[model samples]
Target: MKSNYFFRSIHAMRGLASFAVLISHSLTLYPFFEFRAAAAGVDIFFVISGIVMCLAIEEDTSKLDFIKKRIIRVVPLYWIATGLSVAYIYARYPHMSHSWDWIIRSFLFLPQQPGVDMPILYTGWSLNYEMFFYLILFLSLFIFKNAPIAAACIVAMIASFSAVGNLISYNYFFKQIFIEFSLGILIGYFLKFGGRVEKNLGIFLIFLALVIFFIHNKFASSGFLAWGVPSAMLILGAISFENSELFKRNFVKIFGDASYSLYLVHPLVIWGIEWYVLPEHRGILQVAIAIAISIFISIIFYKWVEKPLMRFLSKNL
Candidate 1:
């Protein structure tokens, strides 16, 4: 089956975001240099999710059909990753106790309450926000026919709720991140209604550089601005440079195809390395080794697990 050029472009962007996160984590593990800017990768992913989900819904399809397709796309791989991570945690830390309710909440992708130990797959926390975004988007479709209006409303509601939730309680990770996903929806609306962003090579390069500088300076100081500003700029860059040669290589496309798997599985690989290989090592060399191991493991997981699942879903579902 052939995918559209637009979808392929989104896939390529996902790959870039995943690699950015990898670099960020590696730098964080070391002492001398810190590149917290990498965390903006998740913000980019959320935006891409919003754009792609809206695009998918633009086709003539019933709500049930839309829900089914999403479930098939997200649930199978998510559950597999969750289950493995939980088992790994249990095996590694046999004395660590967790409640059955916490397990249930994580598995169900429900909003985790404060003081609960997050799931073993630390990155799985993002999936909860993604599921929440889906729920909001699904409900909005019934109340509003205009996709852009619906997306804008969703973004505003999430932002308002996030601000209130943060004020009430200090711990609001889920609420805060959900806003990033909604921002993506707003971007999608812009893409649909505002027409293509005009591309000027020089201006695009300048915007990209400014985005990097902004993310690097702000990520360590301000969590909200770190992801929010750079994510917006990244999406704008992506849409404007859709046909650019910067990301049109075969290897890049392959990485993009496997990015979801890499994102879901890399934490486990990192944890395993920390547990067995580098428990005492905090050197830059150890950081490089950790990153290399993660990339190797993620590549295998992507090729064997993620690619096959997506292919099966596309063909059978």
Candidate 2:
């Protein structure tokens, strides 16, 4: 398949967001900076997921086929990661005791039961949200037959959920974060409607404003504006604007290709650094070591696991 500049840019941004999450998690070790930038990275993924899914599914496809493709794409890698985490926990803390309940929950992608500590694969929680988004998208396939109607519905739902989330408890309202997915879908719809326009400077400025707003608020309303809106704009702008030759270089393409593996594996690397490598270390040294380890692990995982699995999946599925 010929790679488009739009998709390529999205991939690059995904890699950047994944690395940002790794850095954010690393910063948690220091006393000076407690901010978590990693969580914002998940929001970025959510938006991209929505946009990509809409674009991918624009052609007629059965819900079963769509779901099957999703499962093939997501489940295998996820299960492998979860299994590795379980094995690590068991080996390292054999005396601590094991709860089959948590294992089962994690395998099924269910929410962790109250008072049950999540497995070493705590990052898997986001996959639950991803699965939820897929279900919603699958069910709405018929209702969203008309792209404009679908886009309108998505926007309305996001607005409603945002209002509800703000007015109510986070637990009750937090599901509204899925609105980012809808925002992505709307972006695809707009693109389909010939909405491409040259506005890289404007889009970049908006993205900067959103980032500043997010940093100021520490992502309190990021799901709505900082993440959802800006990500959509970025994708649109990237698609509309002409891409430079530099962006199409082999190194950038490789990073984009490895983005997913980087995202999936970085958390475990971060946990390892925090828990074992430099448990007592503090300051910039800790951050630097953690980042170094994360990058190394990300590269290995991408080369050994992600690329091979994607290739196999593409061929078999």
Candidate 3:
């Protein structure tokens, strides 16, 4: 039950999630409303990261290798994006200044300052949580060989501590988002190791979650359960086609490979367009232009910069 290679469905899910986030950001200029809920993509990503860590441990991976790969996968691109974000902020607000300490902490994947949500790169806020989760998984490697029990324990601890330590200073930065990762791990545990996941049940969860999303989209909810649990269900249903030929199509080619690039590149592209190209004319057309250019640039950066850097570091290290 615990054996399988790469799942195209998972990769495809990454592509879809990243695209959803990109769309959400592009809707920033809309006057009537903002598509902030598309940020459920981040929740989706959190769950995905948890599942990935679970998969890594199940593969009998070395803990050091797991950590090393995560660092390599995350750090270089994040640093570059941080540098770009700093430049963008300086240009956009010539008088506004970022704290040097915050910049350093951002690069280190540390939590944001009290009551602050975003980092230098804005989107890099999630990376802070990602790094923290990786730290847990790496340490958990010493004790738990299986992903399920470890995931259960993590979920319980987060729930218990959150209830008791709601006033803790750190909670300002940490919040309750940790549950998304735990949800993902539980899904991974159930699908990969524990037993069969019925297709009908997956379908029902997907439909029920969509209803929740639709309602939340109109009224807007604030809790992780509103977003995170739905995201987990989406992944649960999506990965049901993991072994199928669905994601291998040329047009649907796995943008999952470029997903990180998309995540880091789209905001810069969107902001640049808003600043330089069309400040006054904010409409659907403007969003179209931004998304087109962003995807193009992200692919280019992925091919020329990120891929080469990763390849070089993988070989050298």
Against the true structure, whose TM-score is highest? 3
In candidate 3, list every pair of residues with a backbone clash.
none
Per-residue CA lDDT of model 2 for 127-239, tens digit only, reads 87787667666777766675434643654564576555346533422455667777777776665555665666647755765575457456455455655565555555555
List RMSD in Å for every model shown: 3.0, 3.6, 2.6
What TM-score fits each model? 0.86, 0.83, 0.90
lDDT of 1 by residue, 1-317 (tens): 12342655577879988887777766645645766667777887887887777656663547776676777778889889889888887889899886777777878887567676455567777777777677776776676676535765666565666666445664444355556666766676666665576677435843874666565655564445556656767667666767777568888787787787778777776676667665456678867876777777778887888778878987887
Off by over 4 Å in 2: 1-6, 31-38, 116-120, 142-144, 147-174, 200-207, 214-223, 237-242
Q: Return the TM-score for candidate 2, rounded to 2 decimals.
A: 0.83
What is the Cα-based lDDT of residue 238 in candidate 3?
A: 71
Whole-model Cα lDDT per candidate? 0.70, 0.67, 0.77
Best by lDDT: 3
Poorest 10 consecutive residues by lDDT, candidate 3: 1-10
**TM-score for candidate 1, residues paired by index:** 0.86
